[model samples]
Target: MKQRPWINVIATEPEEIINTIDKCPSGAIRYSIPEGSKIKENVSNGVGNINFENTNLSVVKIKVNANGPLLIEGPTIIIDFEGKPLKEGSKMALCRCGLSGNRHFCDGAHSKQSWKPDQIDK
Candidate 1:
């Protein structure tokens, strides 16, 4: 088997995540990118809140939407539905609501369809 390049992206740095776990914090670090998953960076959807995540791969800037997709960046992985390796790039979008037919990845459907729950006050 080829030793394919891979990077594990934990919301916080793995080191920090580990420390938090050791401290019995409410955080986890079992982050791992399976062989086949959609990966991307710099997506625009309306909700705006920047997040920086660091991994062995690279630094990623993400945006948090009250109810929207997860915008991701570099050190990304694009995989097929049948668990096949696609491409590794530096920009893409991932679905958060699990409504996209594309599944696992975001095709801008969250914005194109404007599919959010009726509760906006939450």
Candidate 2:
């Protein structure tokens, strides 16, 4: 299988999703959309019909917390260093801080450490 480039999108609407994902050089392991929303390719672009199958969008979605773990909202295949598959859930928290006892996964260690990183909105 050909390796695809990892793409990160933070869009809420279909138009926004198309615009953002269109910018990626290649598709990613997952494509993130807002919770309770799905990207519909049938939506018209005013000028013409947009073809989603020709696009690089994927079904995987993730939500980034302002001060916490990344809320991955689907089952994503994660491989360990030894090329073994690790069990992931439909909804899981990935560590944002560098102190997770589980390494990549959040172990709620950030709360104990009281680590708050700077926000981009600020």
Candidate 3:
């Protein structure tokens, strides 16, 4: 009946369901629903959106841990050793372990490497 409106008159099923699985021609499956369609017209803003309700922006702060990655909190930017932007425009933990596969960014390498700070006599 979904295929043809005219066929519905002759259908025997008490109820009808017209479920559609749209597939693009290129082969990338349309698994995720488009945001615009699902979002309500007057819906309130949410977290992780680039545009924030609180326009007052601020720099994030970090605690230099005695040993291990810098425990960064609040808003900040991060870059990798290759000069590639890594997790920019946000707050994140940074590796001081020197063994991070991502380089300059913490891939949790401190745990595997067992990094500990050695205080030097200044």
Candidate 4:
């Protein structure tokens, strides 16, 4: 298995890799087929089968977790207070509770604090 800063994936057959990538909940893994590759066309990229080649504008989607962080998916750039890019990626979990030790990012601290979406003091 190859370990990246974000996730670990086992390098294997193309079909198997695509299958694994499809299971990723964060949408962190993406694959592109080469022009002449033999991969089948029916394989799903797990992102609504978006045809990136035919699109001019990248679509970004954000999902607010029930009682947790905000899930960001698609091409994104996260900037810090100084307006400098802190990170760039296809998926990210941003802290909404302000209790994360890793500011701007979630570290599951909200769970520890029993945070709720309707809580008065976030």
Rank the candidate models, highest lDDT first: 4, 2, 1, 3
Candidate 4 similarity to native, TM-score: 0.56
Tens-digit per-residue lDDT, 37-61, candidate 3: 5443233232223332333546556
Each prediction's Cα RMSD? 16.6, 13.5, 15.9, 5.3
What digit string (tens of lDDT, one per residue) describes model 2 on residues 1-122?
A: 12233333432555655555444321222243444555453433221122223233246678766666776644456678999987543445677777777878876566665546335335
The TM-scores of all predictions, comma-separated, are: 0.37, 0.45, 0.43, 0.56
Clashes of 2: 0
The runs of at least 3 residues in candidate 3 whose Cα sits more than 4 Å from the true structure, single-residue gaps closed, are 1-57, 79-87, 118-122
Error of 2 at 8 (Å): 38
Candidate 4 lDDT for residue 65: 79
lDDT minimum window of 10 residues, candidate 4 = 48-57
- State the C-alpha lDDT per candidate: 0.44, 0.50, 0.43, 0.67
Choose 2 or 3, whichever is better by TM-score: 2
Model 2 vs. true fold: TM: 0.45
lDDT of 4 at 84: 98
Local lDDT at 9 for model 2: 40
Off by over 4 Å in 4: 1-57
List model 1 lDDT by residue over 7-116, tens digit each.
23445654443333333211111233234434222221111212323345457656654566665554656678788876544445567766667666654456655647
Local distance difference test, candidate 2: 0.50
